[model samples]
Target chain A: MTGGYMGRILFVNLSTGEIREEVLEENICRDFIGGYGIGARIIYDRQAAGVDPLGPDNTLGLITGPLTGTPATTGTRYQAVGKSPLTGGWGDANSGGFFGPYLKFAGYDAVFFNGIAEKPVYLFVDNGKAELRDASHIWGKDTYETEDTLKAELGRGVEIACIGPASEKLSLISGIITRRGAAAARSGLGAVMGSKKLKAVAVRGNQKVPVADKERADRLRSEQIAEMRTPVAGGQSFIERFHKYGTSSGAHRSALSGDTPVKNWGGIGVVDFPEPDSLGGDNAIANLAGRAGCWRCPIACEGRLKEGTGEYRYPAGTRRVEYETQASFGTMCLNNNIESVNMANHICNSYGLDTISAGCTIAFAIECYENGLITRADTDGIEMTWGNHQAIVAMTEKLAKREGFGDVLADGVKVAAGKIGRGAEQYAVHIGGQELGMHDPKLISPRRPSQPSAARYQADATPGRHTQGFGPSGFRGHFLNAAGLCMMGQMAADPTKYLVGFMSAVTGWECTMDELLKAGERIANMRHVFNLREGINPIEWQVHPRITGNPPQEEGPLAGVTADIKAQVYWNLGALDWDMITAKPSRRKLLELGLDDIARELWP
Target chain B: MTSRGSCGLKPDSHRLNTSWYEGSRRGQEWKYCPMFRCVVGVFGLPREVTELREVEIELEDGARLRDIIAALRREIPALEGDIICAGEDRLTDNYAFNINGRFYQDENELQVRPGDRVALLLLASGG
Candidate 1:
C-alpha cells in the first residue's frame, strides 16, 4: 500500500450508472505524486484527443494529492481535471478546502466521471461505499443552498464540491464551489461536470491515509509551524498582515505599483484608480464576521464578512473579497465601490462562477461599450459605463444567469468578442482564450526580455495563469501542487527549506529537491504533451498587443514600458527543453524525465 | 523632493566630482540637496523582513544606486541575504526595484537624485 495515497480510485460512468473501484498503482503514486499530476497522467492515457470538452467522451476527475488528508501543514487541496471547453485544451484547476481531505477519508484518492446521466445526480461516497443519487430537488439551487440541503440530509460533516445554476446552464466561466466560497474555478471544468448532469460530490470518511513515517511527519510539521511562529530578529512578525487581511493586503499597493492590471489593461492605476484604499486589505476585513480557512490550515488567511448592513445586502458569512476579485472588479472596471465589489463577489460565489473571468469579462464589456461596439440597447438599457458600481453589480448577476447582454459574455471575453464582431475583439484582452489574471506582465520586468510572469502566461500548458513559476521555480510549484501543499503556506515558510523535507517525511522516500523538481518537470511535460496531442501549440499563438505593451502606457507608474512577451516565452521554452518553434518537448528530454511511453507515442 | 532624471547627473555619472567629500573635509556639512534624498516605499515584503513602511534616505552628491542599496541594508539588516544579497548590489528574485515608478533591473550604475522615490515591491503572482 502507498503510504500517503488511499490505494483506491473510484470510477463512475454516469450514463451506465456503473461504479467501480480500482487499486491505485504505487509506482503511479510515487512518480506522479497526486492532485493534477495523477489526473494528467490518467486523462492523457484514458481520454482520447479531439473529443468535445462537454461531451460524454471527455473524462473529468476530482483527484487529491497524497498529503491532502495527512497532518501536513495546509494539506487541503484537490484538482479538477478534464478537457477545457473554454481553452479547448488540457485543463486542470486546484482548490483548497475541506472537500479534498474528506474525499480521501471517503476511501478514494480520486474519482473519474464520464457520460451524461439520464437525470441530474449527485455522487455520494460515504465511508467505503459509493452510489449515485437523484439530485432533482437541488437541481437549480445555488452552491450554498445545495450544500445546506445536502448537509441536512447526509450528516453535517459531509463535505461537498458542487456546481451552481450557472453551471447547470453550462456557462463556460462557471466553477465548482465548496464551503460556500472556495472554488476550483479555472479551466472551465465545472461546465464539464454540468455537461455530465453531475451536480455534486459529497464525501465523508474516517479512513486514515497511511504515512510511511507518521512520527517523522508529525515532528517535521511541528518544527515548520514553530518556524512560522518565530518572528524575525529585527523586523515585525511575518504572516501578521496576511493573517489579518489575506491576499487583500496587497490590493491597494499592488494597484499603485502597477502590478494589478488597471482599466482592463488600458488605464494606469495611480492615474485612473487612485485612492482605492477603501478597497484595500484593511477595509476588506473591517466588516468581517469571523475568520475562515481550509482544513487544518494554521494561517487561516480567509476572512468572512458580516451580512452587509448598508447599500449592497448579502448574507452573513459571505466570503471576503480577495485581491484578484478586487483588482478585476475595482481597478479593471474603474469601480471602487467596495460594497458593490463585495456584492459582486457574493454573486459570483453563490452562482459558482470564476470572479477573475467574470469581472474581467465585465470590464471587457465596459470597454466595448465605451468604444461604441456595444451600446445600451445591447446591454438591456444598462449604462455599462466604467466606475458604475450599480451597473457592475447588475451586470454580474446577469452574467451569472446568462440574461440579456450577459448571455453574450457568459462564455468569457474571447467568445463574447467573437460574437460582438465590429473590432470588439481588439478590446477583449486575453491570453489564449482565458482572460488574463490581475497581475500585469508589463509590470513584471519591463526592462528584461526574460520576464518571469509573462513567460509563464505565454508558455505554460494553461495560458493566462498566475503564481505558477518558470523553469526550476515552476517545477517546484508543480511539485508542491502535486503533493497537496498550499503555495502561500510554503512561500511564507520558505519552500526551499520545507517542501522537500515534508515530502521525504510523508512518503518515506529519500526525496531530494532535485528529484522532486524532476517529478515536477515530468508532470509539466505530461500536461504539455496532452495539449500537443490535441494540436494546441502556445508558441504560435498571438498575445494581445496591450498585454505585451505594443504601444506601451503613456502615464503613471508603468509609463513607457513595453514587455517583449514572445522573447520571454522563448527564454522559458528553451529552459524547459520545449521547442521554441513547435512548442513540443524533445524526445531526449522526455526520456530524461522517464516519460518513455510518451516519447515513443510522440516520435512514432 | 525632485523626481528622477530631474538632476543633471546622468551624463557625468562615471566622473565623480568628489566636491561634496571635499566640502565635508573642509568642515562644510552635507547640505540638504533635494536631489540626494530618496523616499523609499517598502511594500509586499513580509513583516519579518521589514516593518519600515516608508523611509527617507540621504545620500551624498553623485551617489550611485549601489550607495542607496547599502544604505537600505544598513537601515534594515533583515534584508541582508534574502531580499538584497549581502554586501552585493544584486537583489534576490523576491522583489523588484522601481525607481520613480519605472521598473529597473540590474542597473547599479543608475544615478539617483534626492527626490526620487525607490519602491521595493514584492514580486507577487496569482491570487
Candidate 2:
C-alpha cells in the first residue's frame, strides 16, 4: 500500500455486515491536509455531541483528499460527510465523477458509515475487497435506475454511489446520486444515506498514487496548473462568459443582477419566459454536451448534455448540473424551461433529490399556491402554477413520491411551514432546512466592519443562509468553505493573498491566513458544538420572519436591501458566527480561535 | 472521419475517445478549408468528403447570404467569426450566432451559402 498521501481507512458497518481497516493515520494525514481538512477531523473525532442526523447514531463521513483521485486541478472533489438531516448543520457534501479517484485508488482515505441494516444492503469494493451484498433489487431504485442496474449487474468496470426513494424515505430534501445526473448534493446527505440502511457503493481501485515528491509533487502540480491556466487578473471576460453559458449561463445574469429569487419571495417578474436571456440563453446552448471532469479536474466544469431524447428530452446522462442546480431549479423556481430544468434535474437525480431544498421548497409551494394558502385541495389536483414546467415535472414526482401535498413537501421549508399554517411562515423560502445556497445573499452588498447581517437573516440560523463572517469581510480574509476553496477562486484570490500561501503549501504546516483561520475557526465552532449537542440553542434558530428585521427582497434590485446585523455585532463577529456576539466569547475569540479543543467540547 | 480537436471520427464523440487525449493534442495541427489547409497540411484528410449528416454547405444554387460570406471569406481566414441558422431558426433570430456550436464565437456572425445547412456555432456569453 504505497499511496504516499494515505494508505487506507475504510470501515463500513451496515449494522454489522462488518468490514474494517484503518491504517492511514499519520496524525490523521499530518493535521488534516486533505480536502475539507480530513472530513472535519473525522466528524470532530467520532461525533458524540448528540449525533442523530438521521439516527442509527449518524456517521457517513466518506472523504478523499491529497488531491484525491489525483490530477488535482479541482482536486478530485469527494467529501460526503455527515450530521445534517437538512440543517442540523455540520453536514458536508462534495462530488465529481471517477468516484473520488476510485475511492483514492481503492486504498481509501476515509469511508466510515455505521449501523442500521438488516436487509437492503450493497457495498462491493474491488481492489481491497469489500462486500455487504443483497440490495433487494436495488432498494426501490431511481438514482438513474441504480446507475443503470449496477452497470448492468456489475459488468463494465463499475463505479457507483446511490440513494433514492428520497434517500430511502428519510427525505428532508435528500441527496447522493452519482453519474446519471451527478450530485452529492448538499446537507440532507440523502437523509444521511437513508439513516444508514445503506444501498449502493461499488468502487474499483487499481492503486499507484504514492508521490510525496514525485518530482516535487509534479512541480507543485505544474505551478498550480500554470497559475490556474493563465488568462486572469482581467477576468477572462468572466471566464469566457463562463465556459460559454454553463452555470445556467447565469439565469439571465441572475435576473439581470437583481440576483434572482422570485415567486416565493413573493415577486420578480417574467411569467412564462422568452428572455431571461431567451430562456437562460437557449438553456445554456441546449444542455451543452461537450466537457466533463472530476478526478484531476481542471475546472472542466463537467457539462455533457445530450438531448435526453427528441422533441428535446434532455437529462439522459453524462451529468454535471451545478451553479446551484442552475440557479436553484433554473431562474429561482420561475422555470425558464431548459427542458424543465432538464426535467428538474431528472427528478432530483432520479428521486434522490435536494435540488437546493427541491428548488427552495418548490418556490415555497408556489407561494402557497399564490396565497390562497394551498388550494386545488392542497395541490393533489396540481395548479400550483407560475411558469409551470409541466407543474414542475409533476411536483418533482409529488415531491419524490411522498404523494398528496407531497407529504407536506417532503417535510422541508421548516417542516412544511410547521405543517401548513396560513401565515405560511411568511413565505417559506427556507433557512434552517438548507435552501438559500445559490447566492441571493440579497446580491453581494457588503463593506463589512461588523457585518450587520451583511444583508439580512442577521441570525436566524438554518445552515442554509450561511456565510456568517460575511465572506471574511470582503476578501483579504475569505472563509467561503475554507480548505475546499473556489467560490470561483474566491472571486479571484486574496484570502490574505492565499491563506499564508495556502497553509505553507498544503501542510508542511506553517499557518497564517491568520493561523489558517484557526482551522476555519475550529470548523465553525465545532458546528456550533454540533448544533448545541442537537438542542440547537441560541433559542433554537430558524428564520423567514419575513427575514429578520427585513429590507431586501420587496422587489428585485434588492428593493430596500437591509440587514447590517449590528455590523457583525459591534465588530466582534470574530471567528465568524461566534454564536453571534457573546452569550460569552472573547479570549481573543478563543485564542484567535484555536478554539481550545472546541472550547473544551463546548464548555464541558 | 473529420478528426479535428476531439479526434474527428465524430460519431457522437465516439464513446469517450481517450486515446490519451487524441494524438499529441490536436496536431494534424489546425486550420480548415483555406484550400483545405493546404490539402489537410499535405494530405491527412479534411476532405475525402467528411459530411456526417446535417449537410447544406451553401453555394449550390441562387446563393447570396452576402455571396456565401464571400466564399467563407476566401476559405477560412477564421471566417472572421459568427454564423448559425442551425435547425429551428435558433428561436427568433439574428440568424443565431453568438457562437459555441462548433466554433467562431467572437460575434462577427459568419454568413453562409452554397445551400446553407450551417450548424457550427459560437458568439456565446451567458445563457
Candidate 3:
C-alpha cells in the first residue's frame, strides 16, 4: 500500500536485458534511510568480493533520498554507487541536479543496474514505467554531446547522466556527468558503468513526491530558504565565496591563510610562492566568470567561469572553476594563471574524469621530471614544468586516452607511482588510492578544527567522503540517502542538528539525531565490511608523506602538523558511536545496530 | 604610507568608534590588513550605516537556531521576533555583527573601523 511509503524500486538486469519493478522491503527504508545510506546497502548486497571493479559484477546503482523532490529548497540530490576502479574500495558519489527529482517522479526510490548488456543501451523511464533502449550511436561521445543526443532521442524533458570516451575505456578516475558540467565524480564509478555496457540513464517523471505532511515540508523548506539568504558572515565563509566563484573562490582565502600548497611543495621560487604573491595570485579574479546553483538551491555556490568572460579575460570563458581545480591545476602545478584553471576544469568535465585525481597525477609527474628522476626522453620530449598551461592541457586529453606519457598517469597516483619509481611515490598524495586530498575547511584550518586531513588518505575505507566530516555549520555530518537531497541543502538546513524529527515526519520513521546519525553510521560501517570482503586493508587511512612532514612548517593551522590516526575512530564513528560524545560500542551495541544479516555477513 | 604612521592607536580599537573615520582611510590597519572593508549586502540594511556609534547584537549558537526568537524577544524589543523570522522562516541571529561598520558574522577578534555602523543581518548558509 502507498500508506506505508514503499516508493517503487526498479531493477534492470542489463546482461539479461530484462526490466522488473519491485516494492522494497519497508525495513530497507527504515534501516538505510536514504542517499548514500541506501547506496551503501545496495552496493554491499549486490557486489561480490574481489570482483574485478571494471567488470559486469560491479553493480552500478542510481539512488535518491526519502526527502528528494519534496518541498525542501535543495531537495534534488542523487547518488551513484559501485566498487571504485580507482581505489578498489566501495564507491559512493552524489550530485545535485534534476535527476534525483526525476527518479522520484518516476515513482521509484532507486534503480539498480547489473550485468553487461550485449550492446550499448540507455535506460529510459517515464512516469511509473521503465525501458532499456539502444544507445550505440551516442556511446563514444563526450558528456555534453551524450546528453544532447539523448535529449534529441528522448525529448527535451528527459534528464540524463552519461559518460565520455574516458569512462568507456574504464579509466580508473572517471565520472558520470549531468547538466553538462555537474559531475558525480570520484571513486571511479563511471568505470563500473562502462564495464556494465551502460551508456546512460535518462528519465522524465511527472509524479508527485508522496508526503504524509506536505504542509510541514513546505513550512520547513520556506524557513530554510529564508535562513540561507543572509550575508552577515564576517566575509569569512568560503560558501559565500563559493556562491560567488564556485568552490575556487576559497583559493584566495586559503592561500591568504597560508594553508594552500603551491608548486608541488618543491620550495616556492620555482613557481613564485615562497613569498605570498611576489608573483601571480591576486590577478586571479580575471578568471571569475559568474555563479551557478543546483536544482532549487538558494546558495548558488557553483561557479561558471571561462577565460574570455568580462572581468576574467583569459579566453577560457565561464566553465566552472571550483577550489580543488584551482589547487590541483593552479597552485599544485604552479600554473597560477586563472585562464589555466578555467581550461583545466573544462578539460576534466569534457573527458568525464575526476579533477582531483587528474590534477594530482599530473602534478606528481611534473615533480618526478623536475627531480631528474624522469628525463625529458621519458615525458614525450616535452619538458614537464610548473606554470605551463599548454603542457597541462595537452596532458589532460592525453591521460584520458592513456596516450604517450599520459598512459603512465592514467591509472591515478597509487598505480602510476608504482610505474615511476625513484622516490616519486612519496609526493603522490592520495588517500586509500583515491584522491579526495586534504584542503582547508572554512573557519579553522587543519590543526585548529582538528578536521581529519591525515585521515583523508584513509577515507576510501570510509563509507562516503567529501560529503562526510564537512560543512561549516554542521561541523561534522553525513549525507541523507533517500528520495534525494544535496549535501549543500543538508548543510544549509543544519540536518545534523535539526533533521531528525523533520525526516521522521516525512518518512514516518520517527527519527532522532542519534537515529539519523546511526543510519549514516550503519551505512558507513556496511561500506567497511563490504571493502573487507574485497581484501581491503582498514589501516591504510593516512595523508601523503609530503603533506605529513617532519619539522612541520610554521604558518597555517596545518603548520607544524603531523597526523595521529586511529582505526577504531574510523569504525566506531561509522556507527555514530564516538565514545567521547556518544556511548561506546558494546556487544549489545551490535544488536542495537540491527542488520543482523550485515553483522553475520561481516563477522562470519 | 598606509601604515598607522603618526596616528595614535585608539582605545577600544576592537570596539565601536565612529571617529576613527575622521582621519585618512589608509592608516587604520598598521599591523595586519589595512583595507577598510564593507559588510556583505545580504543584511537587509544600509551598507554604510555612518550615524550609529557601536551596534552589538548577540549571536545565538547555530546549534540553537530555533530559539533565536525567544532570545531576541528580551534583547531587542524594537522589533518583534515573529516579524524578523516569519512563522515559516527565521532570519534573525543568522548573522554576527556590524562591529564599528565592519559586518561580521562571528568575527570574535576582528577589528572595527571608525564612524561606522554595526547592523545585524541573517548569516547565509552558502555551502
lDDT of each: 0.82, 0.56, 0.60
Clashes of each: 5, 43, 38
Model 3 ranges with Cα > 4 A deviation: A1-6, A235-242, A265-291, A305-318, A438-453, A456-464, A470-476, A479-483, A496-498, A554-558, A566-587, A602-604, B1-127
Sort by DockQ, top down from the best: 1, 3, 2
lDDT of 2 at A595: 52
Provide TM-scores for the models.
Answer: 0.89, 0.34, 0.76
Task: State which candidate, 1 or 2, has the greater DockQ.
Answer: 1
Docking class of 3: incorrect
Query: Considering TM-score, which of the candidate structures 1 and 2 is the better prediction for this target?
Result: 1
What is the C-alpha lDDT profile of model 3 across A85-135, one tens digit per residue?
A: 877777877787788777777778789888899999989888888999998
Judged by DockQ, which candidate is best? 1
**A281: Cα error in model 1, Å:** 2.0
DockQ of candidate 1 against the true complex: 0.22
At residue A54, candidate 1 shows an lDDT of: 95
User: Model 3 misses residue B82 by how many Å?
Assistant: 28
Clashing pairs in 1: A105-A205, B35-B113, B35-B114, B36-B114, B37-B114
In model 2, how large is the Cα lDDT of residue B33?
27
